[model samples]
Target: MTSLAAPAATYAEAKDVARRLVEARLAARPLAGIPGPLPDTLDQAYQIQDAAIALWPDEIAGWKVGRVPAAPGEEASSERLAGPIFRRQVRQATPGETPFPVLVGGFAAVEAEFVIRLGADAPAGKVDWSLDEAAALVAAWHIGVETAGSPMAEINAIGGVAVAGDFGNNAGVILGPEVPGWRERPLDSMACEVTIDGRRIGTGTAASIPGGPLESLVFLLGHCAGRGLPLRAGALVATGAATGVHDIVSGQSSVVSFGALGAIACRAEPARPFALGTLAP
Candidate 1:
């Protein structure tokens, strides 16, 4: 586990980190290290993330969920972590390769995912959800790719606390076609292979995500509600990665094949800096 050596950060420190991260993101540059002291707890990490969310100008499109491993000397805060996905960053996949922007010198990867789109708003006051209950809210499921990236190069090396603080280490999502009747199929039966630059890198089924993707959605239901950011209709949730996260770079291309169902192809382009108040790609 990555140790959180610094004491819990104060709100001022959290805001400072958030400001630096947001600036770096807008500039499409990399940070040599975390902007400030690493958070000592998950709650502290969320505080920083919340500050960044407030500073960012985009509207939330949905959320992304990732696993949170137990720390060396502490029980895991939760099995999964959540991050906001901005509306402008969400792009629908075309038949040809979609362009995914990756920040040079920053962390970038492709994760095969089973994405869920909500048909209706979640009850704002409901803070607890069961797997079955969470399934009911799902309008449909799809095969997708999570474009995971961050301005902090060592984002993952520092562990989940750092990940949560930096928008759950997410950049955008590439939504593929709908997988009809997904609820009736077993996740283990739906396998996928991920290739980067024409080389096979990872292969797995949704079962790779503990209890499958719905469990990840279940966690987010409670998580967002607790934060008072209840999920709304049409929100997309990129459940935990199905295939392992595979590193990629600018100019690289990736194809995720969900055997028979379909495949998604995308190419990585260097992320460009934009002036504040303008839309982010």
Candidate 2:
């Protein structure tokens, strides 16, 4: 087996490395013995995850989710796919207008999603919020693209120390048009497709998400709360992909179509290959 990268040399160094990369929107390079495979709880997961982003001195946008079940669609309930998004990246921006500098790589994948922008406060009271309750607070809904490099074999294989060193598998997000029906729309019945150079690559149904969108919010609410973050009204939550995963590479443009709702497109820009250790700074 390929042995995992050494953990950070110390707790402080691990925190600093994670912070530097997150804030700078750079890659993660951990020191030996720092990022150990021991932070098992969701709370611990966010501490490392959040702190990395916290290193950025910008206003946090919202949250991104993955590993949600794909039921009544195609998943066999065994392979749980997941990743993260910068809170700020989840905003209701124009299709091509975004502040983050997107690095271009041909290995891009577009996933269609319904975005839920919070319209109310999600206090961490002892009550279990219902799906409808979570939906009621939506400010708007839009189609989007969640892209990353081709699934790295190491990232797909390891979930702890290794994932941390990879910047939480985040690449970029593109927001499309806002739906009018918003919260009242039935997401499960919605369908979408992934297109590369105008060719259909994959198709998916919203029902792939176990309980649809609110289910994603429920999971996200707790994930943030566990990290001491209250769900603010302006936050946007991406439910998950509507179509199957689509992979792409550089010099190519990709788009995800969710039928009449709308489609988000991103043209990949070339990125220079950075040596593994280049992320250390």
Q: What Cα-based lDDT does every candidate model obtain?
A: 0.89, 0.55
lDDT of 1 at 169: 95
Per-residue CA lDDT of model 1 for 225-264, tens digit only, reads 9999999999999998888778899999999999988999
TM-score of candidate 2 to 2 decimals:
0.73
TM-scores of all models? 0.93, 0.73
| Runs in model 2 lying further than 4 Å from the true structure | 5-17, 20-43, 68-84, 87-108, 124-127, 149-153, 160-168, 182-184, 271-281
Over 4 Å off, model 1:
1-4, 69-78, 277-281
Candidate 1 backbone overlaps, count: 0
Tens-place lDDT digits, model 2, residues 1-281: 35454433344655664554453344422233323443433334445655566555346565555552233445434322223556444534445623323444212445667666788888864235677676666777667766553224334344433343433455656667777775556665577887778888888777776677678787667656655676788776666666755655555776677778776666655444333333333
RMSD of each: 3.2, 5.5
